[model samples]
Target: MKTTSIRELKHDTTAVMAMVANGESVEIRRRNVPVAVISPIPAKSPIERPNFRGRLKEIYGDALLTVTGTDLISEDRGDR
Candidate 1:
């Protein structure tokens, strides 16, 4: 939790908002008494996860390769 004066909030709105954006609750104060509290809004939408396994299967078709990716890259960049 963080505390900020209303005058400070008005003067430095961007910095104050940045704190809220980074998931910190802020207590707004007037005359040294807390008047309002602000917090980051919960993410509303479902997360979109990537289909990595499907993509790999599509690219390779169940055939296991002999070489590691690192070895393949090293072979490609030989004496470079």
Candidate 2:
């Protein structure tokens, strides 16, 4: 971790960014107190749709349908 003042960061924006690009984490301080951090962007995983029903089954088993009684869409629509 590298510590830098806000003024230094402002003065040497490219250099600070270079350090971050090199995978170094920077601690930015304001008035001698730590205020923020700059770090390298993480590699992203392939996006996938979350399985909401599977997650609900894992958490509540068969009780989910029984507990909710009505489908979420119907419940949200009320007595239309």
Candidate 3:
């Protein structure tokens, strides 16, 4: 971690950024009191969409299909 005053940060913006880029956290101070922190942004990971069908199969096997009778669909549609 590195500490920099607000005035120093404003004067040497590039240097502060360089420190952060090297995976160092920076603490910004105002009037000698800490105000904010600057750190490197983490890389994002690939997102995976939820597989509802596979989840249902794992939870209930083949019984999920027939557990809710055909009338459930008709009852849900009636609410609309």
- Against the hidden reference, what TM-scores do the models get? 0.56, 0.54, 0.55
- Supply the TM-score for candidate 3: 0.55
TM-score of 2: 0.54
Residue-level error in angstroms, candidate 3, position 63: 32
On a 0 to 1 TM-score scale, where does candidate 1 land against the true structure?
0.56
Per-residue lDDT tens digits for candidate 1, residues 1-80, read: 99999999999999999999999999999999999999999889988999999999999899998889999999999998
What lDDT is reached at residue 66 by model 1?
88
The whole-model C-alpha lDDT of candidate 1 against the native structure comes to: 0.96
The digit string of per-residue lDDT tens for model 2 on 1-80 reads 99999999989999999999999999999998999999999979999999999998999888735545467778889898
Distance from true location, Cα of 14 in model 3, Å = 0.5
Name the best candidate (by TM-score): 1
RMSD of each: 8.3, 8.7, 6.0
Model 1: residues with Cα > 4 Å off, grouped in runs: 45-80
Candidate 3 lDDT over 1-80, as tens digits, reads: 89999999999999999999999999999998999999999978999899999998999788745546668878778966
